[model samples]
Target: MKISTTAQAGALESNDVLVTVMPNDQGGVQIQLETKRVIFKQFGKQIEEVVRGKVSEMDVDDVIIKVQDKGALNYTIRARVQTALERALASGTRD
Candidate 1:
């Protein structure tokens, strides 16, 4: 059972490549993603880690993620990236 967090509106830019993929730890992976034009610079890594670690195909490709980014942080770079994956997994959507 995959689940998403409250970080949906985190994306600030209209179109960009912001995504992080990784594996889930709990019984099921939980995705936590968000985006902003300028979130705290410190949070960028947290976002990246979420993406890199949670976006790959694990034991079951069942993973979770949270993307919150702004133009300032590399973290902002992957918000949409994650979203794209989510869309694909959910409805076979594409960029």
Candidate 2:
């Protein structure tokens, strides 16, 4: 799925994560992740892998993704990214 506009999901609350998806003019998936842990360098890779997998499964290409993790699990991150992508796709169709 192609992202036609910017969309986001989830919250900053503990055990939750916020995911944002936006159109990328340069093409390809770009991911930015923020977390409070000092081990973000490691967790960031894990988070990126999860988002990349989901976007690939959804057949999405050329978009920017931003993730804010508040102690959320891998599954939660995946769900939030999926939700954001879906919302982006839905909004695109409505436009």
Number of the top TM-score candidate? 2
TM-scores vs. true structure, each candidate: 0.30, 0.94
lDDT on C-alpha atoms for all candidate structures: 0.46, 0.90
Off by over 4 Å in 1: 1-14, 37-61, 69-95
lDDT of 2 at 64: 96
Model 1 collision count: 25
For model 1, residues 63-93, the per-residue Cα lDDT tens digits are: 5554534343444444454555555454422
Poorest lDDT segment (10 consecutive residues) of candidate 1:
1-10
* Candidate 1: C-alpha lDDT: 0.46
lDDT of 2 by residue, 1-95 (tens): 68898999999999999999999999999998889767486677888899999999999999999998888898998899999999999999997
